[model samples]
Target: MATPLTAPTTDPGCRVLGLRERKKQRTRDALVDAAHRLFLTQGYGRTTVDEIAASVDVSQRTFFRYFANKEEVALAVMSDAEDYFIDCLRRRPADENPLQAMRAAITEAWLELGQDDQSGPAGVTAALELFELLETTPTLLAAHLRRTTEQEGVVAGVLAEREGLDAAVDLRPRLLAAVFGAVVRLSHLSWTSDTAAHAAGPDGMIALIERHFDQLGPALAGSWR
Candidate 1:
């Protein structure tokens, strides 16, 4: 079980994993909140994990238990969207074309139909700040790449089922799934990086994805060998 962020210390043989999990979560949350504040006030390169721990009143060792280091904290926080995407991908239809199923699922999961059309207002600004931070940090960039790899595997597994492919289909769907998922991700990146003109807000994400499917449709269809 994952450790909770709030645990001061745990017995080597403690029985309640749930409490420990919650404690670890609390500690991780504290560290992230501290680090985020420090990042904005002092800048990303200027911040340190020790300083984040100090600000949160946790020992640096406790901080390490939740995240290997400061970069990992940013990685963990920035990964929430990808994590959500994985869950939605799993819930998509087993029979529908993988890309088409993705269209409805992604829109319903992340885009609110009314209002600002971004994420919820309560969390929008924080998410945007995190997006901006990822733009410049190489460590976070690498972590994001690894996150994308995991998402690609998810897409491939769903595609295999949707296409009713057997073991003989080997490498085909894997590449297509990765390509499609990457384009979908890039569409959101464009939206996040430049939102000033997004009158449709995040709806631009789905529209951009549709354009990819349209442009690539002939290519995708022809390759179903």
Candidate 2:
């Protein structure tokens, strides 16, 4: 069964951030919004840093202060989502196994994002478009894959901490992390290739991931005959 979406709590620190920090955050958000809009409307490759900066009415130097390059801004939303999933994983119940924790964390994170009013309907639509954009664009796809690889270690470390294992010495955490990541990547590939799945959007991708995770045990341990 799917987990029900719950309201996200506001961080008290957000309220206490000084005026300068708040202003910086607003500028950063504006830049991200502008970048996504440009990336979706114009092809990611065609969108320039100057154009993104211009859209936010910020100078190119100010844009560089927030993001290193166009690719960084292009991926900023996804990076935030990944961070949220890590946060969710950290909060998962200790009784759950690593794979179960990972699966639940991702589902919880996506559901929360889907229900967020700040994200809105237009934001959801943009996310769907961005998924397609990432899959089709070679440069972005390569960068995305590289980022995914880098994140596996972080996930493994989290799992290790949960299980009280040494991630560097004990390979189980890393193994589980690799398997989980592979399952997610496979689901994404399948989603992108199938027209029907692609049409179903983020929900379809999540369902597909759940189905693939369900098959892991059977595929690894059960006989084909």
Candidate 3:
């Protein structure tokens, strides 16, 4: 779900439309911005595709050209962050253990996202806003859960590939991935609590993750306070 904003075309013919491509990129950005604002105001279910397009002064056809549906647009920014996390996971040091790799990769991904790039501060704020929306919206929450489950399988496959094991045959990779996913879910749940002091930004989320991860060993050991 790479946005045209940062995606470079490798096709030779695409080189000819360098200026044209820039214009299209601007359109894509405008549509995404409009969609986010509309969704925030009208709610996800109430926001129609036509209205979103109308907000950007584009036709529904143009919106369809950039995004297949409202869901795609709603999740597009978060999707980019997810993609970066996966890529970071893949590039982690092979010698590291699974948990260590996961932590390091995620930390790097968060750090990278905090930079002055496309999805920097503004995008982080937008993502957090959408996350809060998803939490309260049943439809979007279900979709988010489904994506989380699917991502666990994808990550398990990546782990299996790294460990030189058949993902279908080796249960260890899948088991570890599931456990890791649960940890992430729990961390998010704790961090999202109304009384939680975390900033709701990249740094705050990272701190919550690290804190929860640090507790995994003690929890497994069944140590009482």
Candidate 4:
């Protein structure tokens, strides 16, 4: 089943105070942060939305404004990485094969992710912190899997758009996207195992992803075709 996305709420209740989409994003961020910390403390399934709502200093309704359920939000909250991932996909050179382009782009992009918040994106430590929190908790595991699966549809769409009504265009792009997400997630889990080692930023990650491409590059062949 397609996971339901909650419509952005428009209500400006005392606690909410604005248009649904803006309110939704803020509330989502707040609730996710709260749940993240709480999961680290109380365990994932044990941390109730009510508790998350309480910690974020918002009421139940305010929490609902952003997430349909604690599971969906908690599971999906850390997914801000997709934007960077998409950017990497876009960075492929015009002359490069789609797969090779994606590989190079991802390698370079991951290096960018290693930069400190001062460099503007979530730094090495932050990425590991989020990954660590997710790794240790089985409750959030299913949610993580679900979120990863959801990313395939997104990748598929990106791939489909690149092809201009070509009858022979294969489903390779969607398959490639799935494989790419899996590889990236695997690489992330590996690097984050001792994030401090990669704290200097992209150099280590570029090396790691380059190695991943050595093994997995074929999966992305003709993906953007």
Top TM-score hit = 2
Best by lDDT: 2
Q: By summed lDDT, which 10 consecutive residues of candidate 2 come out lowest?
A: 1-10
Error of 3 at 128 (Å): 1.6
Q: What would the C-alpha RMSD of candidate 4 be, to one decimal place?
A: 8.0
All candidates: TM-score:
0.69, 0.86, 0.82, 0.67
Error of 3 at 105 (Å): 1.2
lDDT of 4 by residue, 1-225 (tens): 111122133221214345655655656656766776676667666878899899878998988877788766665534655555666666555666556766776665555544423221123344445566678767567678887788777666665555432323676777777777787777767666645546744465566666777777455464644
> Per-prediction count of colliding residue pairs?
13, 0, 0, 2
Instruction: Write one digit per residue (lDDT tens) for candidate 1, span 19-103.
Output: 6665765666667667777776677889988898998788888888878877777655446555555556667777666667777
The candidate, 1 or 4, that scores higher on TM-score is 1
Q: Evaluate residue 10 in candidate 3 and report its C-alpha lDDT on the 0 to 100 scale.
A: 20
Candidate 2 positional error at 150, Å: 1.5
Q: Which residue pairs collide in model 4, if any?
A: 9-20, 111-202
> Deviation in angstroms for 213 in model 4?
1.8
By summed lDDT, the worst window of 10 consecutive residues in model 3 runs over 4-13
**Ranking of models by TM-score:** 2, 3, 1, 4
Instruction: Score candidate 3 by lDDT.
Output: 0.73
Whichever of 1 and 3 has more TM-score, that candidate is 3
Q: What lDDT score is found at residue 193 in candidate 4?
A: 60
Q: What does candidate 2's lDDT look like per residue over 1-225, in tens digits?
A: 111122222222224656676577667767877888788777888889999999878899999999999998887777777777888999999999888899999888777766652442135435656767888899888998888888889999999999999998999998888888899888877887778767776677778889899999999899878
Q: What lDDT is obtained when candidate 4 is compared to the true structure?
A: 0.60
